[model samples]
Target: MADKVVVFDFGGVLIDWNPDYLYRQLITDDTERRRFLTEVCSLDWITQQDGGQPIAKGTAELVARFPEHESLIRAFYERWHEMIRGVLEEGVALVDKLEAAGVPLFGLTNWSDETFPWAWERFSVLRRFRDVVVSGRVKLAKPDPAIYAEMYSRIQQQVPGVAPQDIVFIDDNVKNTRAASALGWHGVHHTSAGATEVQLRELGLAFA
Candidate 1:
């Protein structure tokens, strides 16, 4: 049997990325902040960026639609790095354990091509991954089987003899995890670092 490899999702799984953290600072009124996030810079809108839309174009389109909220929309990408609070220490520690145990690490994340640089610059833990498939760069996102297949292929290429079934994918979204499971990869629906550590242990991955 080929050795098992661990695949991780970046956003909620390893990093604490919340737009509200940045939006709350920009828009003082809680109600108005919520409104802006919901009606203007929504998750759906951001997903487009993740799907390879340039931040410049996305912000411009949103500004054209909601002209009055232009500045707010511009701030979305301009100050995007501020949205990421930091790496989840527990998650990082788990990764560290996996690394120490000689397990190969890889990342698969639905992040904007333009804004990913900010994260790439801020977080050193991301560098630990042997390879990372970014949605924006590849123009594919999670819950889409293509991206998962791409990740599997990339891993296979990097780690010779590894098969799809030998990979364990960890993601915060159940849909993404399910999609991975459908692809024959072991899926871990990450709730907490401790829980994930338990799951990895169950899989026979030694972590001290």
Candidate 2:
């Protein structure tokens, strides 16, 4: 933990971000809500940049994607930002602990730049992160070999002697963790705060 880099997934791991919060704000009709979530928005598109698209574009795309829900797509877009806004206290504490311990932490999230600032404003915890690699900025999402490649390459150039394998990745998506692990980097699939804390402790990353 002295000089190792720790990569974290933002949405589920740190801040209890949920898409339903936004849906409730926009669609009030029970039947319309059911149709929008299950059939239109797929209920969860936070990591997919459903939160990033502007109200108009997001709505248009929604309509295009789900013709039957075209009429309500614009309304869905209006509430998209509000959906992915909450932050988990436990997760933010973990980040603070890891940061205080001198771990070179980075945020690797699949998000678009469009909605990042909006969410950022709502969640101040993002201020703690400096090395953020967003899909919208890099144009490469997680589980893509290239995203991890670029991450390692950039870190190596910025901090000499840093190896890809020296980094530990924690993500909620098993596939994303697997991809990082395949690159010789250690990875943990985080499903809960307790599980992630265990990994941090095991990796000598837990803070006192």
Candidate 3:
């Protein structure tokens, strides 16, 4: 129960996310939609990408997995980012409280490169925190040990003597939290900002 570093899951825990949202918006044609989802945009594929695969390689392979549907894959990706728009206010409120408290917060997220820019514009919130470890940029995603290791390394390099126990990571995904714990980092399964405040309170971090 040490008070120190906090890692956060950017997508579901802090920002609102739903796969169906993008799928619904990006896919309208019936046959093309079916082929795009099953062959090109499968959750299993996303999971593999989360496991720390190359986005270009993973995407290329996925597109190649269906010889007949490569053109549809191109169109599907072209419209993907427009589906994601903003953050959930409840999450941002807690983050704002933590920022106001001067607690060091870092994001450990598994998201594509495109989604965040739009979200940042909509929420006007990314600059408030430090170290946004996005899978797209880092080429490593969550639930994979590499992302956590890289994040810890970067934090330590930036601010010397900041240990794993000093950081508390919050995310909604169980696998992600568990993986981070295995790496000796403190992580939490985020439910709501109200509840998260209780956990951070113990860590001497501000939460609202």
Candidate 4:
């Protein structure tokens, strides 16, 4: 078996980030909080920012649409740090094991360029990556083939003759994993660290 090159998706996989962490503090009522998150500041809305839209523009446009929830919408970016709880320890452990075994590692995350700096400072695990492809910085996000292609190019530069089939990509989102798989990568859908470890072992990556 060829030694595997692993690519990680940071947000839900390695980092525990949820908008509810901040929204819970601001909106006391659970129902109202759910409604606001679904209606006003949804994933689709933030994804545009992740795809390189300026925070100011995304916030202003959102505020304009939901004028009554102005404070809340603005807080999404202004108080964005609160949204992060911390690193997923188990996931980080997996990364540690991989590195110790001399596996090549890279990151492909759909994160805002402006907010990524905050995460970089807080999470040491992120620095563990040999290189990271930030969607906001590159103007391409996950589930988009272009971003995966870009990552593949970078991987080739580092690993020389590494083929796509020899790369294993772990992501919390099924769509992202599927996209990578479609392009000849070994995509592992990460739900939990234990489950991911099982999948990795099955793929002949016995890093334990």
RMSD of each: 1.8, 3.3, 3.7, 1.1
Task: Note the Cα lDDT for every prediction shown.
Answer: 0.90, 0.73, 0.71, 0.94
Name the lDDT of candidate 3: 0.71
Ranking by lDDT: 4, 1, 2, 3
Candidate topping lDDT: 4
| Higher-TM-score candidate of 1 and 2 | 1
Q: How close is candidate 2 to the true structure, as a TM-score?
A: 0.81
Query: Candidate 2's C-alpha lDDT?
Result: 0.73
Give the distance in Å from residue 67's predicted Cα in candidate 2 to where it truly belongs. 2.6
- lDDT per residue, candidate 2, 1-208, as tens digits? 4456888888888767665676665678878777767766663453355234444565566678778666556654465556565788888888878888777777788777776677777777776765777776776778889888878876776678987767888898899999999999889899887888887678765576
Measured on C-alpha atoms, candidate 4 has an lDDT of 0.94
lDDT comparing candidate 1 with the true structure? 0.90
lDDT per residue (tens digit) for residues 1-208 in model 1: 4568999998888899998899888999999999999999998899899989888888889999999998889998888888888999989998999999899999999999887887898899998999999999999988889999899889989898887788999999899999999988999999999999998888777757
Q: Rank the candidates by TM-score, best first.
A: 4, 1, 2, 3
> Worst lDDT window (10 residues) for model 2?
46-55
CA deviation > 4 Å runs, candidate 2:
1-3, 24-39, 43-58
- TM-scores of the candidates are 0.91, 0.81, 0.77, 0.96
The residue pairs that clash in candidate 3, if any, are: 4-166, 5-166, 5-167, 5-168, 6-167, 6-168, 7-168, 7-169
